[model samples]
Target chain A: MPYFAQLYNFACWLIGDRVAAEDLVQETMLKALRGFSSYQQGTNFRAWIYRILRNTFLTSQTGLKATASLDSEDDALPEPATLETPESILLVRHEQSAIRSALESLPIDFREVILLSDVEEMSYQEISQALGVPMGTVMSRLSRARKAMRGLLTAASEGVKR
Target chain B: MTCDTWRERLDAYIDDSFPPEELNQLEEHLRVCPSCAAEALHRLKLKHATKAAAAARFAPSSEFRSRIAQGMPSRRKRLFGDLWIPGLAVAAAILIALAGSSVWEWHAQRQQALAELVDLHVTTLASVNPVDVISTDRHTVKPWFQGKLPFSFNLPELENSPFRLLGGKLVYFNHAPGAQLLCASGKHQISVFILQGDWKFALSGTFPASAREKGFNIESTRSADLRILLVSDANPGDIHELAELLKAAQQP
Candidate 1:
């Protein structure tokens, strides 16, 4: 489902570990299901679900003590391994992975806003609600996140050229 | 404005959050400043990359769905044998009388407690102290709770799910130490509170089991000696499913 994948991708990016991200997402869904009756209909379900995912990620005990790191060096990012990919599709996948790695390498605050805005396609207001921050904060964070992502991607590209 | 100022404003300009005058100024500055122009182009590329990465969505595997389903409490099982029918009828009859007697004192206390929890929930939504500790490892989250509360709580990592471990914070609910677990689903936030108490004291036939106040939903359930409360604006069905999954994870 779009809902599940969106959450999963956000989780993977947030935690930066696929295995841990998967577990956190599962718990998030479980909690979401239990509290389904309280969800307001016709409202922003994505925002609501995102809030749950954020909270679940924060409280999980798995690696809470590990200092937050921005290193994407260890991330075994999903590569396009399917056979018979058109050259264009392959190019697009490569670009996507590069961008993903760059995004993942940014600070948590930066990564969060970028994912919400550019990736998740959340409006500034929706991001403010999900992040429990002011709209200004969302805008500022997104701006910074984008800048950081650009710097990382540029650096990664240069490194590849060497 | 100088190039630096224009560069700073580039983000707002790109997002179209700037006023018309400011936007016009930024455009003029970019036209004259090649450095700023190049930076803007790079920023656009980054934005495109982010969009492309986000657009590549992945679905939850069938196994994950089955696992979540298995984790939830079976409503059908709860409905079998008309188990709660007699209890519900009896509860209905005594509801009025129970409101008046000291025999319902504990229920009143529990209601007050829930109200306090609702207050805490609202404050958390408005505050920045969502988690006291942040980590992605289960070992990190589990031990962090030690000595932070009057009792021990287990936090199993469900990395296979959408909820990634953002962090944990220590909070007080009803003057008792409570642990707040933070997890995320996409951009959504969910707060899980595990309280140490005897559920029997709180469920004494009078207190409402679940209620939605303000815009948030609060649900409490008991497993053995632990009482868990999930607070969010997410669908109640999702919360219930999460509770069941949590219960399953806690099992041996």
Candidate 2:
């Protein structure tokens, strides 16, 4: 039962629509239940279910759009490690909004890395298995994603300053 | 090693997944290079803030939950010639109800109330304007709910706490009016619901102190004749801090 909430949250973030995310999670659950026997013992079950959810997303319309943008160089954010993360940034309302909008505007690939690493707190290996990507790719994507997030936050705070 | 190489490793280090040898090198570099150290700090802060901002999320309603539960593939039904086992189970349930109906009803009612509370938490957060009485002062908000709800709950002193009193509003549960006190903890808004604790379906005192539903954490406790239920997406530690503060304030 708890699995449903986490899956639904993951699906919602991927699809960007509440209604669609519900349907996606329901489908994922059904598929998981029917294929329970196929799941081997002692494997990373969370990673396996996430893989199913992500795979399901990859076939959906929103996912196709994200796929198209995956290689689009124009969507890449500048590397921004210079910005300070002074815990108080989120304490302020505008800064909080800035962080959220920055996330929501990110390319789906970047967004997923941020979510998996930071929000879901999945390991590199687990994330690798879930996304069907190699460990190195997970590392690179997560690195770039954080850099991009930092970049956006910096820009948003500067905009507020003006 | 160059800072660029160290930068790449810092990301891995922040996740605490790097090897000991690599960590020794990274730690050595961090001591020498202020810029690299600052960059690492930036990533840590970003991860924390991102997690906080992404806290409030949606969950399926109770209807959808039961639909999934009932719809799960029953291995027994598959093996026992279809309806045969289900029919017998229902007969057994009827016999049990006749024997101790309150026990059966207790479980169902508790689940339903918790689900409804979570629903209210989500719905209130989603709505454009959440509370009727909007004030950050505990003195102001506590009195506002005095007449609106059947029971009163003490609003904790949040001066040194992570939470701040948001306000209160009247909410109905199972057609009974209750007080919903909203509190802000960082980026997350925690709802403290005080309802008549003496209702027929009183919690068994063994209610799990905390449970997560639809992305939010729901914690329940009883103070006098009032049931204090809190719902939020704040970090668990922060939730516990606020819960302790509330528990202290509810003291007679």
Candidate 3:
């Protein structure tokens, strides 16, 4: 019950369907209850449960399709310094809707890392455990995700002005 | 620091992963570099804005929560829901083949009750005020439960043992009033439930039959009308040792 709302929020974004997200959260709860016995004490229970949800999502039909859609174009990132400009101070201040759209438009892997880090406010260690990735991967994914998000917001703001 | 070096570590700087010395250097650089300053401000604003958007965007409806609660396996109305049955004879035949489904049903129900008790134990562990009386001495914990229950049970001496008497509380287990003695062995919190009821649920034996149920190793025993269940996440062997200690300390 404590993390239900947050779990549902993550589910909605991960699956991108309201009805399916609800079902996914329910399935996750059932699975967690069944496997609660295996959960060790003094470990990050939140990360443990999130890991189960991630594994469940990765195995679902939508998850498989989402995986296939992982674009390789952005794998080669420009130096982060190149993106630093004074214009970003104003560009990043777009409306909440703009931010949401930018977040939704990113690739699922990047979007997930951002959600787990910024929204859920999980530690890099927890994110690593939840995503089954190394801590370095979490940081790099977050860095790239934010960069891509900045580009999307800038483009959206430009479109709105024109 | 060069602009490139400062830029590369900017994300980690914002994340507070840098040591105090490196953070001071980054701060000094940010003060001197206009572009880097603007970038840091933008990232800070973006972080706040994204957190706000996420908080507002995808809240699950109240209906969603109710749907989940209804569908939870533990709260289902029946084990098998609305299966078509040809006749009572067929049902009877199936029950016979399953070695009397009523006994199996009873066992399932008992396990469910144990699961609820385990939930109660964990909840107690999670709560700040786990017990009514707080004391490390058995003398204090034993007397505290005097009027709390309709019955009384002896408390074991926890001295010179790994387990310490933390406290005791009054609780209801399966609608029957019971005294819950809270204990701690090393780092593990243990709940010993003393209820005034028949041992309707079988717990194997009085010699510390340690079996894991609902994430806790439960060591249960019965002496006359008193039924005691010790619940802990500690290893089963340690719990068994505690059980033996309890049996030896019980008054004759």
DockQ, per model, reads: 0.15, 0.13, 0.16
Sorted on lDDT, best first, the list reads: 2, 3, 1
Enumerate the chain B TM-scores of all models.
0.54, 0.59, 0.58
TM-score-based ranking, best first?
Answer: 3, 2, 1
Regions of candidate 3 where Cα sits further than 4 Å from its true position: A76-94, B72-252
Give the interface RMSD of candidate 1.
10.5
What is the lDDT, from 0 to 100, of the residue B138 in candidate 1? Answer: 68
Q: Write the per-residue lDDT of candidate 3 for residues B99-215, one digit (tens) a residue.
A: 745544454445545654665676566434567689988888888877667887777767877888888877656545688888888889888887764634544332234567646
lDDT of each: 0.61, 0.69, 0.69
Q: Which structure among the candidates has the greatest TM-score?
A: 3
Residue B198 Cα positional deviation in candidate 2, in Å, after optimal superposition: 62
Model 1, span B1-252: residue lDDT tens: 577677667776655566786666677777887778776765565566567766644555666566544543223322112212333333442463345555444534554455446545554544434465788786898788888688876766677776676787777554356788776656766778888755445555344556775456777776666778887777777777677766666666
What is the fnat of model 3 with respect to the true interface contacts? Answer: 0.31
**How well is each residue in A52-128 modelled by candidate 3, as lDDT tens digits?**
67655654567656766676635543223355443344444556778788778887888888888888888887887
Model 2 interface CAPRI class: incorrect
Model 2 stretches with alpha carbons more than 4 Å out: A73-75, A81-95, B72-252
Higher-ranked by lDDT: 1 or 3 = 3
Query: Which wins on TM-score, candidate 2 or candidate 3?
Result: 3
